[model samples]
Target: MSTDFTQEQESFATAVAAFCAREAGTREQRDALAEHGQHTHNQGLYDKMAELGWLGATIPEEYGGADGSVVDMCILLEQAAKGMAPIGGIGPTLITGAAYEKFGTASQKGAVLGGIVAGKSYSISMSEPEAGSDVGNLSCKAEKTEGGWLINGQKTWCSNAHFADRILLVARTGRSVAGGVTRQERGEGKHEGLTMFDVPADIDGLNIVGIGTMGGKEVNDLYFSDCLLPEDSVVGVEGQGWAQLMTGLNIERLILAAMMLGTAQRAFDDTLEFITQRKQFGRPVGTFQALRHRVADLATEIECGRLLVYHVARLVDENPTKLFPREASMAKLKLTETAKKVALEGMQMMGGYGYATEFDMEKHVRTTLVSSIYGGTNEIQRDIIGKTYGL
Candidate 1:
């Protein structure tokens, strides 16, 4: 992977950094933008970004977007995250956008992608209480009806749903393959009968409940009780949601990896600043061989992660229609786990001050800890990568 950023890329990063710093540079500014201390999805700021054409980073030109490449999207996200901007909704939104661009009908694209470029957010309800890692095993059934599909099931960890205009929903549409085999009879019939639907967030019989965590009110649990939709709500073909989902993982994982890379850099930079200033026995603590070597090791790891990220990003960019499951998973795993290490190590190095809410290190810890878990756990990513090699 090329380590150089073009002049245009450099300028774009600078612009993003300036925007984040100007908009949410201070603790008070960030707190005010982040509702209830949540560091994700500040709609007010997101609208401002939309106005600036940044929210359309992933959408195509037909939807009033910039038609930017994956690398371009990564640049924007990385810079925003490095600046600690609270635009968490962008990640999930882009992941959802990728699906629509790939599998959505013209109307579906017009509604979702166009809305996204216009500052409207979206979410995906893939995981259930029972289908976190085993997404293929989801049981959220959507039965056929005269009007449309009648969805009835529960979905959990629907990220940013409360702030979204629509949710890219995946549900079961069949119980057997043309009366050939029942799901149980086939064993691990995780992929059959699955379908994707573009559901309005405020649709009747669909409920969105917040799930609170250290990250605040970001994710949600959605309950669908007889949620009726139009026949046109079906995205792409029925019973093909699994394949559509697989196609989008490259984007989803890369989006997350880019953000985490920025976070790791920020944590490392903050720690370096602190150790260089804080005195230990009449000298800067960072001057110590032990601390210096530790810092060096982390910086090296982050550098390696960055290379792997852009490498996979370029691969995806070169062939947007193709999949690089092994490389993308490796990028996701490397950046997320390395970010966790960087954040935790920074906190440990900062001692009491790091734990204090006054500093951003603690927040970095809170954010990075979850990166490895979401976007599929690091263990799952490892499995994906290993399976490619006949493991």
Candidate 2:
């Protein structure tokens, strides 16, 4: 099958590329801004993007969004990654907003979707110290109360929590696993016990503690102690958070893949520029046969990564209900691995300059490493793919 972007999509991609070149590209500027622990996109850039309707690319126009396709969003994300833009804060927001659009109540959509479209940040809080990959084993408890629910637990590795206005939180409310529930009773038994809640950042008992990450992005450890949310806070239905989370994870993986591909492309571009200028043995290093072959291999792998990410995006847009566990896993696995390889190769090609803080390759390496670990590790992704074949 051939992969070609529509004219409109191509135009949008061009616009994003120009925006990144002007606003976010360059290691010194990005590093300086990220040091503040706030979003790297300043108010000026944020407002510009919001005005251009880029912030709400995946949101429906009815809710003040751009009413764009997921492919369009991927395009923007890829460009941002190529520019080395710090879009981590916005990435989860798009995925969570779509989740709310897909499964949240009317009020939930009205409250959450509008804020996100307005350029306010949001994050998803699912990982805990005890439960990173094994989300089913999460111990965060949400006991039903007279008004709403009392949440008491800790969540770690919550990205953008420091600046997020809200979080899409998952907590346990029932006691059943994969195959125990009957067909009629399955919705309740399989998903009935878990619940999703929209929790505001400033809620009285919610505490956010910042954690330093390798890539200079700030993640947080969240503590919820008797934090109370109204009954209306429940996203789709009580005890269905697991199912809802599963429903949106495919999109999440695709988004992560897009971001990795973008970063990898940037690394490749930087490496090309470096080798074209940097001389070794009295000639440009890029002219050497060994390095030229390596560049060719990296280019081919990146094409594979792009195809995998775009294929998953198309599949999701085409069939929102069909499970794409294997495809999503493959995309995440391939893109992150490719990102890591590209960064490493870029570093090797650049030699000492690549390791120096003056060059972006060092930061790119750190960032790519974190991407592999986030959204589930590459090992876990491989395991999921393996399990799909009934291994």
Which candidate gets the maximum TM-score versus the true structure?
Answer: 1
Query: Taking the candidates one at a time, how many backbone clashes does each contain?
Result: 0, 4
Instruction: Write one digit per residue (lDDT tens) for candidate 1, span 161-258.
Output: 99889999999887665367676457657687799999999999998999989999889999999999999999889999888899998999999999
Worst 10 residues of 1 by lDDT: 176-185
Clashes of 1: 0
In candidate 2, which residue pairs get closer than 3 Å at backbone N, Cα or C atoms, i.e. clash?
174-193, 191-239, 192-239, 194-239
lDDT of each: 0.90, 0.83
lDDT of 1: 0.90
TM-score of structure candidate 1: 0.97
lDDT value, residue 242 of candidate 2? 84
Positional deviation of 178 in candidate 1, in angstroms? 9.6
lDDT of 2 by residue, 116-227 (tens): 7787878899888978887766778898889898999999998888888889998876675457654324534433467888999899989999887665546889999999
Question: For model 1, what is the alpha-carbon lDDT of residue 385?
Answer: 90
Residue 311's C-alpha lDDT in candidate 1? 84
